[model samples]
Target: MKKALRRYWQTDFWREFFDTFLNISDCQNQPNLSHWGRKISVLLKEDPSRLRETCRLLRIQDETILQAPSF
Candidate 1:
């Protein structure tokens, strides 16, 4: 189960996440952003380095943007 989740996190997660964000952004949904932000905050608290590595693997250059959720 962990492996499957890890795989999803590394792959489909980013795609779906970005897609969802774009949709939410287009709709000007603040609540959805807050919900997603909480999830990201929890993930960051769980493993910062791993998150960083996953972002790096995904070629996510916006480190500050990624870290913003935990603030």
Candidate 2:
């Protein structure tokens, strides 16, 4: 299950994420940006450990996110 999600991590899900993230340059997109931010916050809060898997799957370079709780 994890492998499959990682394999398609760059699909629609990531596309929307990157689009919202990259749109930070525009003030008008603040709503969209905050939406994603809240969503990420909720997910991380639910399972901090998933942060590491998320980083690995997304190829994120931030080591800080890996400090999430386990199990």
Candidate 3:
């Protein structure tokens, strides 16, 4: 049961991230897959610590969500 909950949490987390990235890229007018790919690469290159922080926050969020009573 816990594993399934975590899996669902992970899926939702990534989906939200994808939506946010797409929105921030502002490429709805002229979408370019390659450009988006390059942007992600640049983001990682600029500061990997941000990625670590994101992961840390995700862990905390997962714990909080899991502790809540299921409806």
lDDT of 1 by residue, 43-64 (tens): 6668888777666655544544
TM-scores of the candidates in the order shown: 0.41, 0.38, 0.41
The parts of candidate 1 lying over 4 Å away from their true place are 1-9, 24-31, 51-71
Regions of model 2 farther than 4 Å from truth = 6-31, 60-71
Number of backbone collisions per candidate: 0, 0, 0
lDDT of 2 by residue, 8-70 (tens): 533665677777666677765474557778877875668766777776765643343475556
TM-score: model 2 vs. ground truth: 0.38
Candidate 2, which ten residues in sequence have the lowest lDDT sum?
1-10
Residues 1-71, model 3: lDDT tens digits: 22222334346645755776567655455446687677656665677875666567778778888998999
* Candidate lDDT (C-alpha), each: 0.61, 0.61, 0.61
